[model samples]
Target: MTIKVLVVDDSALIRQLLGEIIRQSPDMQLVGVAQDAYVARDMVNQFAPDVITLDIEMPKVDGLTFLDRLMKARPTPVLMISTLTEAGAEATLRALELGAVDFIAKPKLDVAQGIAEYSQQILDKIRMAATSHVRRARRGESGPPANFVNSGTEKLIAIGASTGGTEAIKEVLRELPANSPAIVITQHMPPGFTTTYAKRLDSICAVSVSEAKDGERVLPGHAYIAPGNLHMHIDKYGADYRISLLDTERVSGHKPSVDVMFNSLAKCAGKNVLAIILTGMGKDGAIGMQAIKAAGGVTLAQDEQSCVVFGMPKEAIRLGAVDSILPLEEISRMALAELNRLGAGTRL
Candidate 1:
C-alpha cells in the first residue's frame, strides 16, 4: 500500500524538500501541502492523508493547538517538526502528550539541505506513523491497591518502550504506589524531550519521577528516565544501585537503547531486576531482554492485542526472553503482584 503523506509547514523550502523526499520513496505518495494550520485543516478534509508531517511554529494557529483539534476531530497519526531549541523541546513534549505519534528535530542551520540530510529517516517515521495506532491520551491515577505495603525488595524496574510507549509506560506507572520499587526507563526519544516526558509522568504518577542524572543513587519510589541522546547504565554505589548516563555510540539505532540499559542491568543488578518491553516498532530491546532473562531476572512483555505495534516485545517473546505477556491494562496490576512475589522470594 502506498503511504499517503501531507506536509504542513510555513516554510516553502521544507515543504518542497519533504515533498521531494516523499516522492522519492516508492512506498509513499505526496497527498498535499499546507502552508498553515487552516490550510492543513482543509487539506485534511480533502486529502485524508495517512500521515501528516506538522510544523510546530506556524502562523495563525500553532501546531500543538492544531494537533489537539486534529486528534479530537479526525484522530490521525501526526509527526511534528520543531526547531532544535529548548522551547521547541517543550512544545514537542506537549505534542506527544496531546497524541502526536512522533517528532523530528528541525535543524538549526542549513535550511534546505538539513531536511534532506535525514531523508531516509524521515520516510521511515512517516511510514511508521501511517500504520501506527493513535490512541487517546489517558489520564487519572490508578494507584496500586488501597492496602498496598512496601515489600522492601530493594529491586528496581527497568522498562523500555518506543512508538506508542509513552501512553503504555504511563499506564503502568500510574498504578505504582509511593513504596514501589525504583524504575529506570529508556524510551527512544531525542535530547530535549526526555526531561519533559519525565516531568509529565511525575505529575500523574503516584511515585516520584525525574530524568536520570549521571551517578545518582536511584531510590525506591522514584523513577528515572534515561535522558535523550545518552545511554543509561546501572552501577552499584555501596549497597544501592545508581544511574550513570553516558554519551556513547548509538546502540540499535538509538542513544538510550533498551538493549543497552537491559544489558547493563543484567551485569549490575542481575536477578534483582524486572525488565519490561512495551509497545514499539523495532527490536532494540530483544537482545538485552535475553541477557536479563539469562541473568535470572523476570521479564514481561506487552501482548500484541494491547501493543500499538508489536515489534519490540514480539522480538523478545520470539527470542524466548519474556517470562509472561500481558495486555496494557493488566501490566500495572501484574507488575505489582510480581514485585510482591519476588520480594517474598518466590520464583516467577
Candidate 2:
C-alpha cells in the first residue's frame, strides 16, 4: 500500500520540493500540503494522511507548540524538517520531545540545484515516519511522570532503539530516579553524538549516566549507554553483569542494535533482566525480545501512543514477545516495580 503523506511548511519552495520528492517515490503519495500548523490540522481531518513532514519555524504558531497540540488532540507521526543551525538543532530536540518521529536538516542555500541531493534521505525518513505510533496527550498534564520507579525486581535493565531513538531515549531516561536499575541502552547514533548524548543525559537525570566501557560492571544507580559504531552486550562473570563492547558487523542495519543487546541479555542475564523495546525505526528487537521472553525474562514494549516511531516495539508486540505495553513516562516506574517484584518473589 502506498503511504499517504502531508507536507507542512511556510516556504512555498520547500513545500513544492518536498511534495515532488514524496510523489516521486512509488511507495509514497502526497495527500496534501499545508503552509502552517493551522492548515495542517484542517488537512489532517480531511486527508487523513499517514505521515506529516513539519517545518520547525513558521508564522502564527511555531512547530513545537503545534506539535504539542497535535499530539494532545490527534496523535499522528510527524517528521520535522529544519535548517542545520544551532537554533534548529535545539528546536529539533524539543520537537522530538513533543512527539516528532524524526528530523531532516534543510540545506543552507535554497538553490533548486541541490534540492534533489537530499531526496533519498527525505524519502527514507518519510517511510520510517509512516510506521510510527503516536499517542494523544493525556488530560491536564505536560510534565514528566511524578511517580517514576522500578520496584519489582533487582535485575538489570536492557533497552534498544534506533532512528528517532536519541530523543526518545532521553525522555525516558530523564524521568528515572537516582536508584534506577542498571540500564544498558543501545541507541543508533553517530560516534561523537553518543558521547554528547550520554553527557547530556547525565546532566539532566537524577541517576548517574555514562557511556559503557569494555568490561565495565553494570551497577544500580547508574545508566550506561552504548557507544556508537560498536556493539555492546552484557556478560555475566559471577554474580554481576559486565559490559562487552565489540567491533562487529551491523545487525539489522545498526551497529548498536537492540537485537544484539537483547540477545546477550537472554544468554547471560535471562530471568534476571527487564528488557524494554522503545520507539525506533525498524524491527531490530523483535526476535531478541522473544528470546528474552522464552528465557523467562520480563519484557515491555512502549505502546503506540507513547512511541515516536513504533516500528521496533510494534514488531516485538506482533511477535507476542512483550509482556506489557506502557507509555514512555510510565516505563521507568513499571520497570522499577517489576524489578522490585522480582526481587521480592512477588511477580515473575
Candidate 3:
C-alpha cells in the first residue's frame, strides 16, 4: 500500500527537500506540496492525503491553528516539522496535544548538506504517521478524583512511551494526586523539547515536575523526566534512589531508552517499582519490563484500543511482563491504587 503524503511549508526549499525524500521512497507517493495553509487546505480537500508533514511556522495561519481545525474536521495523521528552539518546542508540544502523531526537528536548512542527514528519520516518521490512529480533539476534563488518596508508600513509578506519548503522558499525570508517588519518565523527544515539556506538565499537574538532574534524589510527590538524548536510570544510594544520567549508546534504537530506565529500576528499586509501557512504535520496553516483573515489581500497559500505536505495550504483554492492560485514562488511577496495595503489603 502506497502512502499518499502532502507537504505543507512556507519555504520552497523545505517543500522540495521533503517532497524529494518522499518521492524516493517506494512505499510513498508525493501527492501534493502546499506552500501555505490556504493552499494546504485546498490540497487536503482535493487529495485526502494519508499523511501530512506540516511546518509549525507558516504565513497567514500558524501550524497550531491549522492543526486544531484539521483534527476537528478532517482528522488526518500529521507529523510536525519543527525548528530546534524553545519557541519551536512549545508549539510542537501544542501540535501534539491538538492531535499530531509525531514530530521531527527541522533540518538545519542553512547548511543544506545537513538536510540529507535527516532524510531517513523523516521517512520513518512519515511511515509511522501513515499508520497511526488520528484521535479527535477531546473535551477538557476535571482533575483527579477528590476521594483519591496516595498510599505514601515511597515506591517509585517509572513510565516509558514514544510516538503519541506526549499527550498520553499528560493525561496520566493529570490524574495523579498531589501526594502521589515519585515518577520517572522517558517520552522519546529531541533535546530542546523535553525542558519545555516538563515545564508544561508542571504547570497543569498537581505534582511538581522537572527535567531530571544527574544524581538528584528522587522524592515522593514529584515527577522527573529524563533529559533528551541521554539515558536515565535510577541508582540505589543507601536507602534512597537517585537519578543517574548517562551519555550512552542508543538502547533499542533510542537515547533515554525505556528499556534502560526499566532495567535500572529492576536492579535498584526492585519490588518497590511500578512500571508502565505506553503507546509507542517499537519493542523497546518489553525485555526490561519482563525483568521488572521477575523482580516482583508490578507492570501495566496501555490497551490496544486506547493506544495511538499499540506497539510497545503489545510487545510487553506478549512477553508476559504486564500485570494489567489498561486504557490511557485509567492508568493513573490504577497506578495510585496499586501503590496503595503495595504500601499495605511491603515496606521496601
TM-score of 1: 0.92
Model 3 local distance difference test score: 0.89
Error of 2 at 265 (Å): 1.9
Residues 231-331 of candidate 2 have per-residue lDDT tens digits of 99888876668899999999988887779999999998788888988888779989999999999999998888867677889899999999999987787
TM-score of each: 0.92, 0.73, 0.96
Model 2: runs farther than 4 Å from truth? Answer: 1-19, 27-50, 55-76, 82-89, 105-121, 135-154, 163-171, 237-240, 327-329, 344-348
Clashing pairs in 1: none
In order, candidate lDDTs are 0.85, 0.80, 0.89
Ranking by lDDT: 3, 1, 2
Q: Which candidate is the best by lDDT?
A: 3
| Ranking according to TM-score, highest score first | 3, 1, 2
Tell me the tens digit of each residue's lDDT in model 1 across 95-114.
87789888887644465565
Which prediction has the highest TM-score against the true structure?
A: 3
Clashing pairs in 3: none
Off by over 4 Å in 1: 108-116, 139-148, 344-348
Quality of model 2 by C-alpha lDDT = 0.80
